[model samples]
Target: MALWTLFGLRQGSATTRWPAPGGDDGQADVLGMPRYHPERCGDGCSACADACPTGAIVADAAGGLEVDYSRCIACQLCVEACPDGAMTASGDWAFGVRRREDLRWAESGDPPASPAPTAGYRRSLHIRHVDAGSCNGCESELQALNNPIYNLHRLGIFFTPSPRFADLLLVTGPVTNAMIEPLKAAYEAMPEPRWVMATGTCAVSGALTGGGYAAQQGLGDILPVDVWLPGCPPNPAAIIEALLMFLDRMPQRVRGGQYGE
Candidate 1:
C-alpha cells in the first residue's frame, strides 16, 4: 500500500463532523470580532474608536461611538485601547447576516429576525468566488475548506469555476477600480434567483483601503449582497457557518453587532 494510504488508515478520518451537534468546527482559542458593551463604556472615552484602523468604530452624533461590524478587521486594536471594558475581545466568529444594517451595534430595541432561507438552495449550494484585489488571506482560508480537516464537499457545498452554474457569488478583497466591470459581468452571468456573499471584511466594507484612488469601497455599491461575512479573513469554520446560515440550516448568531441570536 502507498505511504499516504497507510497514514490515512492509521489516522482514520481527519474530517470534522461540524455544523452538526457535538462535532468540532476546528476553531479553538481563536479570537473573533470584538464585543462592544455600551454599559461599560467610560465617560467620553474615545480610545476604541481612535484605535480602530478601519474606521469600524467611529464617533456618533451623540458623542458616543457607533460600531460598524462590516468594516471591522477584528484586529483587536479597540479592545486593547479601551480603558474601560466597553470594548473587549471575543470568540464569537459567526457574524454572517442578510442585511448590512444588522452589522451595526445597537443599544436598544429587538434584534432583527433572520430572513427565511431561500427554498431552492436548501439542499445544496454552488459558489463562484472572485478575488477583486485581495491580499489572499481570505483565499487561504477558503482553500482549507477542501482539506481533509474540513472536507467541505461532505456538506453539499461546492466551489464551481463557472458563474452560470453558481448559486452564490462569493467575493473577497476590497474591489479595485479595474475589477468593477468584470465583477458586474460575473454577477450578470449568474442565473436569476442567484445570491451574493461578501466573504471578508475587505469585501464587506473595503477594510482599511476604502475610498482609495485605485480601489472602490466594498460590494455595497457594486451588487446586492444576500450574506455579509466580515473578518480580516474568516476561518474555514466561520465560512461554513455563514453558508449554512444563508441556507437556513443554522440560526444567525450575530445581530446589531452583538454575537448570539
Candidate 2:
C-alpha cells in the first residue's frame, strides 16, 4: 500500500483542467469532424458523397452536397475522396447540440446566446446510459470519462446504474426494434424534468441501421432529445466537453455542425 501511494504521488494530478483555460487535452491534435466548403466543390461532383460509408454525405435533389454531422463517423474518406478542395480535415471535435437539426451542415446555427443551464442540473448531472443496439465504439469512449485524465467525477457528473435516479438518459446504439420498449421504459423510469441525450452517430442518425424494418430511425425520431452528441463514437474529450456544455460549465463550440470560437 505504501509503495502504491508513493507511485500515485509521483504520478501527481493527471486530471485535465480543460474547459477552464490553460489546458491542452489530448484532442488538440486529433482529427475531429471534417469541414466542408460547398462553394469549393465541383459543379456536379459527388466524390465525397460516394466515399462516405454511411449515408452522411448524400447529394440533395438540387445537386448540392448534404453533409449530416450526425451520421458522420470521422472516417476522413470524404476528405480524401473530394477531387476539389471542398472537404478539408479539421480539429473541430465539439459536436454536441441542443437540436437535431443542428447536426445538419446547412441547417446548423450557433447555440442560443444564453449560458443558462438546464433548470435542475446546473451544478450536478446524473446520466443513465442505454445501449439499444450500438456497435460499442461509443461505449468505449464513455468508459474513458472515468479515467484519470478526464476525471468526469470531479465535475459532479456521475453515471447512475438505474434510470429512476438519473436526470438524463444518455443513449447509444441504433434503437433496435428489440430495444425500443426497454429504452422507453428506461426513459420513463428517469425522474421528472429528465432529459435525453443522443450519444454517437448511430443513436443520433441511426448510422447504417436506420430505416430498417425492425428498428427505429433514430433516438430523436422516437423520443424528444435535449442534446445530440454525434460521432462514430465521440472521443473522450469531446464527450466531456458536451456534458459540460449541457451543464452550462462551458460554451457550445458547434453551430450548424461548424466548430467556432
Candidate 3:
C-alpha cells in the first residue's frame, strides 16, 4: 500500500529553467518608474493626463511629460493614450521600506540600511500567510512563489503553515472585523523580532472597499507593517520585487510629494 501511494505521485513532468517565461530573475530595475519618449510625443494634447485616474501623469508647456509615480496607479492608461507610443511601462518594480515616513510623500526620513553584502546574512525566512477578507488575488500571487519559475526557496524564503515557527507574517485582505482578533492572535503567537508584510491594495491603503463595514482599519492600524506590496493583487513579479525589497536585497526608492498631491 505504501509503494502504491508513493507511485501515485505525479512525475516525469518537464522542468523549466529559472525565470521561466514572465518570471523575475532578481534584477532590480534602477529606474523604478515609467519613462516617456518626448520625440514620440505629439503636441500638448493632455489626453494622457485626463485619462489618468489618479492624475499621476501631467503635461508641460514644452509638450513634455511628467509622472509622479507616488500618485500613479500603474493603470497603463497613459501607455494607451499616447498616440505615438511615447509612454512605456518599465518592469522595474523594487519598492519597499521599513518606516511609513519613508513611504510617505513629501516626508524625508533617514535613509534605509545598506543591503547585506554576504549572501550568508540573508536569513531563511518562514512566512505565515493569513487571508483576512481578501478577494483571493493576493493568495494567487503568493502561490506563484512555489513555482519553479520564481523559486522563492532559492533565496531561503519559505512559507510555513504554523505561525509559531514563522519568521515573517504575510497578510492579505483589508482587516475585516471578523478577522481582527485572529490576525492579532497570529502576530502575538509568533516569536520576537518577527516581520509583517502587507500585500495588495486591500491590505495597504484599503483601495476601493476600505470603508466597507466588514473592513476593519488598515493593516497599519492593527500591526506594524514592515513591507507594503501595493496593487490590486500585484503581479507575480511585483510580489517578488516587494519581498526582495523588504529583505534589503534590492535598491530602495524614496518617493517625494504628498499622498494625493
| Whole-model Cα lDDT of every candidate shown, in order | 0.89, 0.85, 0.66
Backbone clashes under 3 angstroms, per model: 0, 2, 1
Clashing pairs in 1: none
- Across residues 16-60, which tens digit of lDDT does each residue of candidate 1 receive? 878777889888899999888888887788999999999999987
List the pairs of residues colliding in candidate 3: 106-257
TM-score of 2: 0.93
lDDT of 2 by residue, 1-261 (tens): 699899999999988887578876778778988998988989889999999988889988898988889898899999999989799999888888777667788544564554434844554788999998888999999999999888888889999999999988999998999998999899888888888889998898888887789778779878888888988789988888888778776777777767786
TM-score for each candidate, following the candidate numbering: 0.96, 0.93, 0.65
lDDT string for model 3 (49-112, tens) is 7777654567767776665443444567787777777677665454444454444333333444
The predicted structure with the larger lDDT, 1 or 3, is 1
Give residue 107's lDDT in candidate 2 (0 to 100). Answer: 41
For model 2, the run of ten residues with the poorest summed lDDT: 108-117
